[model samples]
Target: MRLSEFSVPDTLAARGALALAEQYQSEAITAHALRSWVWAEAFALVDGITGIDHELLYVAAVLHDIGTVTEFDNHTLSYEHAGGHVAIALAAGAGWESERRERALEVIVRHNWPRVDPAIDAEGYLLEIATGLDISGARPDALPREFVRDVLDAYPRGALAAEFGACVVDQAERKPDTAARRLVDGGVLEKLAANPLEAR
Candidate 1:
């Protein structure tokens, strides 16, 4: 399988987000974040999607699941909203301008949306496709089969299905109006478990 061609952003924002995710997120979550970035980048290339801000996508991808972390997780906010807020503060600390910081917030929050308008936010569209693919194995044809396997080999799923599912389940129970609740009501846990990626 000797797959070593993959790489990720090393810019200040990318590096800062990576560090933040490492420090606050669990092993499964950190892996999910990394995989999300890889998948997002792949989608950009394969789909010929352009006008992407690599740093922004990298930052959003790495921190998309931030709210699932204990430090950022809260009782009132949906994880996506909490994660968006966390990204805003973290991006500010990383010296991102107000507009860029707000964009990051939008990208993070919109990643959980049913669909993102690519014309409006390329980063959000990519993140949604990538995260949806990574966590639930939706739209399996978006990427080549071998490439998917290689990416999985490099970043194993470990307990992501269990850990992330539990987090959403918690969110559903506490914040019934959020997307997390809808996902739970829709049997997200079972979907995660049955995700074809698990067999990769």
Candidate 2:
């Protein structure tokens, strides 16, 4: 499968999602989100995950962490849930049908899951694994080493480790019941700190 087919979607919602992510998230987070797209697309190409909507993955990648921003943060909701609701609203405004809007929500909400059955939601499963690869460098051999190098060179991780760490830590402090707390208490910081991608 050629990788040329996997790329940022040119749809209205995709553009809006990127714009909103840039407007609301810090630069590190925005780059992290975009890197997640690159990772997801790369994974899809290698794994031959065809026939799905690339636009949905792009939208999910860009806005999956929007709730981490102060503007969208929810005290009672996990960041992914907050981000999913925000994505659903944006999708509706972008003229998506109800099913597509809901699917976008599913992709964003499940991006952090440890596992998502690909038969049910390929985009979610892709995003979950992609974000894992980006954030913690899980399954490093899944993608070509040269491809990973090109992507990191193009996007650069910047201060993602520090920036995202503080954000999640803050989220944990405010919402002890959420996944952020679980990640914090489970030593996700150490994982991020030790992530292979963090190196130049």
Model 1 vs. true fold: TM: 0.94
Residue-by-residue lDDT tens digits, candidate 1, 81-200: 888888888788889899999998899999989899888889999999999888778888878888888888888999999999988888888889999988888878988999999877
Worst 10 residues of 1 by lDDT: 1-10
Candidate 2 clashes: the total is: 0
TM-score for each candidate, following the candidate numbering: 0.94, 0.95
197 Cα displacement, candidate 2 (Å): 0.6
Q: Residue 179 lDDT in model 2?
A: 81
Tens digit of per-residue lDDT, candidate 2, span 1-200: 23344667788999999999988888888989988988888787777888768888899999999998889998899999999999999999999999999998899888877789888898998899999987877888887777777778777888999988998899999999888888798788898998998975
Q: Each candidate's lDDT (Cα)?
A: 0.86, 0.87
